[model samples]
Target: VKRIIALPGEHVAIRNGAVYINGQRLIEPYLSEPTLWRGMTLDHEYVVEPGHVFVMGDNRNNSSDSRVFGAVPLSSIVGKAWVTYWPPDEVQVLTTPAYAFQ
Candidate 1:
């Protein structure tokens, strides 16, 4: 699963199975490939509330995030994911999704 690397008040959407923030598609070089949108709604637009953020997992088809539990308030954010100590090959420092901040 991918961690939420960005915050609220940003425009986001999924198209052609790719995620776009603002107007450009995010180059998620880490993703296996284009993801599938399952159990995700594209009908209603969401404006993230102040001090809150929207989060989702990389496994879009199996994630239960803002799409299910709704936006997460900043106070609820336990902490930033700082490392990938497990699965040595996948170990690396995570970066925020750049496009999300555009």
Candidate 2:
């Protein structure tokens, strides 16, 4: 699963291992490490289409998400993340994070 980093019409960029949306650095408290990989759309400033959103994996270093595939069409998203069952110890219901853009 991936986190939606940019909304429709928003500009996204990756620099110095951080994500910027519309020129504002995104505050991501859930990331275990900084994003170290780059991809086609995220390599430089990219504008999200009106019907698309930019997504990224929590484990940025190893995930092959929007960084590789580009912004995902909103209609293409089939399901929401419901729970985390892997590793047993961390199993729990998932909730959408609230983001405050400055």
Candidate 3:
């Protein structure tokens, strides 16, 4: 699963171990560590299409998401992830994070 990083018509870029939206650094309080990985999109800036969204894995340094496949069409998303069951002790219902674009 992936987190929607950039909404339609938004610009996303990654540099210096952080994700930036438009020209402002994105405030990601849920991330366990700084995003230091680079992939197809991380090396440059990209704009999400009108019906698409940019997605990234929570495990930034080890995920293959929009950074590798480009933006995903909204229609392609079938469901919202509401629970995480892995790692046993860390499992719980997921809550939507209030993103603060810095």
Candidate 2 versus the native: TM-score? Answer: 0.87
TM-score of each prediction: 0.69, 0.87, 0.87
User: Least lDDT summed over 10 consecutive residues: which range in candidate 2?
Assistant: 35-44
Q: After superposition, how far is residue 47 of candidate 1 from its true place, in Å?
A: 2.2
Go through the candidates in order and give each one's C-alpha lDDT: 0.65, 0.84, 0.86
Q: Per-residue error at 35 for model 2, in Å?
A: 0.9
Query: Per-residue lDDT for 1-102 in model 1, tens only?
Result: 436634678666666767666646677766676654445565334566678887878666677777677778888777777667779878888666554322
Give the clashing residue pairs of candidate 3, or none.
none
Give one digit per residue, the lDDT tens place, for model 3 in 4-98: 89999998888877899988898988889888546454468888999999999999889988887889999999889999898999999998988
How would you encode candidate 2's per-residue C-alpha lDDT over 27-85 as one tens digit per residue?
88888788764644346788899999999889899998877888899999888898999
Highest lDDT against the true fold, candidate: 3
lDDT value, candidate 1, whole model: 0.65
Better of 2 and 3 by lDDT: 3
- Candidates sorted on lDDT, descending: 3, 2, 1
Worst 10 residues of 3 by lDDT: 34-43
Clashing pairs in 1: none
